[model samples]
Target chain A: MSAFVSISLVYLAIYTLSAWSLNLQYGYAGIINFGWIVFQSIGAYVAATTALGSPTSGGFQTYIFGARLGFPLPLIMGTLAGAALALLLGLIILTRRIRPDFQAIIMLVVAIIAAEVVSTNTALFNGANGLSNVPQPFNGVMHLSYNNYQWFFVAFSFALCIIVYFGLEWICRSSWGRALRAMREDDILASHVGINVQALRIVVFVIGGAIAGFSGALLVEFLGTWSPDAWSFVESFVVFVSVYVGGRANNRGAIIGAFLVPVVFGTMPSFLPEFGYPGLSANLEWLVIAALWLTTFYLRPAGILPEGRFIARRTRAREQAPVMPPIAKQGSVA
Target chain B: MNLYIEAIGFGVIAASSIALGAMGFTLQFGLTNVLNVGYGATMSFGAIVAYAAHLTGMSIWLALICGGIATSGLTLLSAKTLLRVYAKRGAALFEMAMVTFGIALIVEYAIASITENNTFSLTIAIEHTHALGPIRFTDVQLALVILAVVVFILLDGFLRLTKVGTALRATAVDPDLARASGIATGRIVTIAWLLSGFLCGLAGGVFTIDILTVNAFTGDSLLSLVIVAALMGTAGSVRGAALAALLLGIATQLVSAAGASGYASAVAYGVLAVVLLARPKSVQGGLVADRVQITV
Candidate 1:
């Protein structure tokens, strides 16, 4: 395969993972977390910091948590870091009697602040230059060929995606999932029904963060580098677009949507004809994405496939019976 | 001590830009009740308009007016054509915000594509600074502060005294109730949009003059700060926004002066976080989670 295809696939895998995490949060849980990319950035930073080893006396950059974690530790650390931050923020913002829109703005502000902090403090991940020279997982031991590595990642990413997909599907299908749906529909009512709404949101938010981190770990290790540029507020929007374009509540829909939007729409721009200037094409690509967002909302407000409404059996019976038909209950049929 | 004074002076300048943006933002938000994320894009358009006018040998003041006019036209047009459509379709508050966000992306990206993502610089001629005690400011900065103060006094007077302003305030309180009271809610909404759009444009132009540079993401970068200021001031309070902007501006300056220049914006953000965490209840009305189905 050509370099372009390989690189595209790498981005696709990472974005797919990110979208999956968003799907779990916004889709199943109905949490309007506008600041979605912070978790991804955290995951990337943690993974990078852990894998780069310690900054020696003559080192060029400085960072905290600088230690060689080898293969699995970096990934674990990344996931945990993302989850921890989410838990902390969730406790503060997700609680309280504030408005959801305000909650979203707060999240966006938090993301902006996170980016600023990371860009400023060099010790926090080597500042804006970011962490590079990151070794691939198992490169020395496996001694894999280039093609082999690509295939290995493909298989590995696919396996993880499958596991996450199924794991999330199970969670969404269980009683816990029903509780979440209840909270999404009406938090106050859910609380009245004995559901600890705040706790539930925090738990799901943390889990979502972990998934985002895990995805970032998989991505950084595959690409062999991570930086502030790797994550931006725009990254959050990309995943969000996919979740909305696909069915919001369906896991399968989320994956399919992610592939279509990010893998296809996002990558296609690179191959387009050169526009007026160098970055013009990239700018037009975003224009197209924005147009797509508007068009989808206008054409398919409920997405390609709308989420199935879960009707209680008791309510289902009443719906079927129809207390009074518009046409006198079809007297002839009776 | 000198550095502290200088920071304070610079903070006031920054606050002037933020105050202009926030007032317009709050008006549109208060009356229409749409978050209007496209606000930043509109500001960018205004800046571009001003830049184009400048290239045509127009005076900066005239160019500023042109920018404000352009922004006002676009805001009213978008509100009538695009926003009305979604709003008519029963799109909720959050969905309206998403729609505006998408529109903003289109506007910003179009500008970027056309401009080739290059930054443009606009120099303001204000070499001389006046010293008062330890604080000093250039003629331009002084002008900005005066303009801000005038705008505040005028807005406050308008809101309190004028019939149109009364109607606007009434609509903000309850659109349905305002309509029932024989007030033309639609006309009031249009007035709010026009005024807000004009101010937004003026803010962008002023910002470019101060920073001496404009880019595609200029408005996007400042948007978070603007929102923070508006929200911290309680969204509907013009005076509150001014006060918040002043606080933010000073805090940012102080941080930069303290040698943590890279984290200056973070300091502003840190203030926002503390406010958010400390009094989440204060922001309850603004935080109501509305279901918005966004797709791309």
Candidate 2:
């Protein structure tokens, strides 16, 4: 396969993971994490900086906490960084008794704030210039051509995607997910039912944050570069558009929706005839995505592939059998 | 000491613009419960209208009125067409926000496509400067402050002293109750939309003049700050929003004066997050979750 196709597959896998994490949060848990992209940026920065070793300071880029680490360690560190950030923010956000709309706006504010802070405090993550020349995993061990290395990474990403997919699927099918649905329906009622709503939201948020970070780590490692420009607050909306357009509560819907929106539509801009200028297609791409979002809400609010109904299994055949009760005679009015 | 005083001066100017926008935002949000993210787009469109008027040699005051009228129409159109449709479908608060966001994207991008994404400078002819104590102000800035104060008095009086205003307050608190009380809740809502839309557009025009630049991306970028003020002030209270806007403005100006200019606008968000963390019950109104209706 061509390098282009391999690159596309890798993106598909990465976005699929992101969509899944966001889906779990917004879909099941009803935590509107509008700042989701910033967490991914954290993972990318941590992964890239750790893999790149110490910054030479005056020699080139400027950043804090530069250390030379092995491939797996950087990836692990990236995931941890994402979780740490989420754990910190979720502590405050989840504990609040605010409405969902308020929560969404707060998250939005955080997303914008994170971008400005990161770009402004250049010493933290090398500012707007960002980090480049990040080392790729198995670069020497595999001894493969660059194009083939991409294919390898794509396969690796897909494998990780499968693991995460099954893991999240298992969790969603558990009692925790049922509780999450209840909370989404009514927070006060959920708390009344003895469910620790705040604690559950925090748990789900952190887990989702970790997944987002992992995907970011995988993506940066594959690309061998990281930048503040890579993640914008609006990008979170794109991930949201995917999860929502796919199916709010369905994992399969998330995967398919990710593929359909980010994977397919994202790459389609390349095939479009150039209109006015070079960046025109890119502009039009976002426009199309926006149109797609509006169209989906109008036509199929339940998504193309709606969520499946969850029904618990019966253990015995007798339990599955239907029964009818005896009716009272019309004349027997005591 | 001198820079601190100077920053306070700038903060007041910033606050004036922010206050106008926040007042409008809080008004619509308090009554409609749409959390209309597309407000940013409407603001930009309004500013654009003002910009067009200025190009045609209209005075700054006329431009503001023109923009305000245009924005009011746009706001009502959006509320009636887009937001009402979704609300009718029983879309929840967050879903309504998503719909508004989609509308915002369309408006912002269409402007971008039309304007070709170019930044246009707003010309404010500041003829003279008046100085008092350690502060100095251009005539344009003075006019803005006056505009803000006048709008506030008018809106406050409109919301308090009039029968429609009473009806609006009633509708805001409980739409069904207001409807049952023979209040013509629909007309009051339409009036709210008009008044808020005017404020929204007026704010846009004032912001462009104050900042000295206008662009397709202008309103959306300023939106976060506006929202922070509106939310922090308590959604339905105009006085609360105005005071919050003033505080935010001062904080941002002080931050910028301290040299971290990029993080200045972020102060509003910091205030919000800190407030949320500090007082959950107060912020959530003591554990009573009010389901906000998106319709009039």
Q: Which candidate is the best by lDDT?
A: 2
lDDT of 1 by residue, A208-326 (tens): 99999888877788877777787777777778888878768777677667777887788767876776768876787788878887888788877787787676567779889968757
TM-score, each model? 0.93, 0.94
Question: Would candidate 2 be rated incorrect, acceptable, medium or high by CAPRI criteria?
Answer: acceptable
Interface RMSD for each predicted structure: 2.3, 3.0
lDDT tens digits, residue span B1-296, model 2: 99989999999999998899999999988888888888888889888989999899999899989999999998889888877887887787878898889888888888888888788997676799999778899999999999999989998998999888888999999999999989888888899899889988988888899998998778976687788888888787899889998888889999999998898987778888777556555345322234666774
**Model 1 CA deviation exceeding 4 Å by range:** A271-275, A309-334, B285-296
TM-score for chain B in model 1: 0.93
Q: Which ten residues in a row have the lowest lDDT in candidate 2 chain B?
A: B281-290
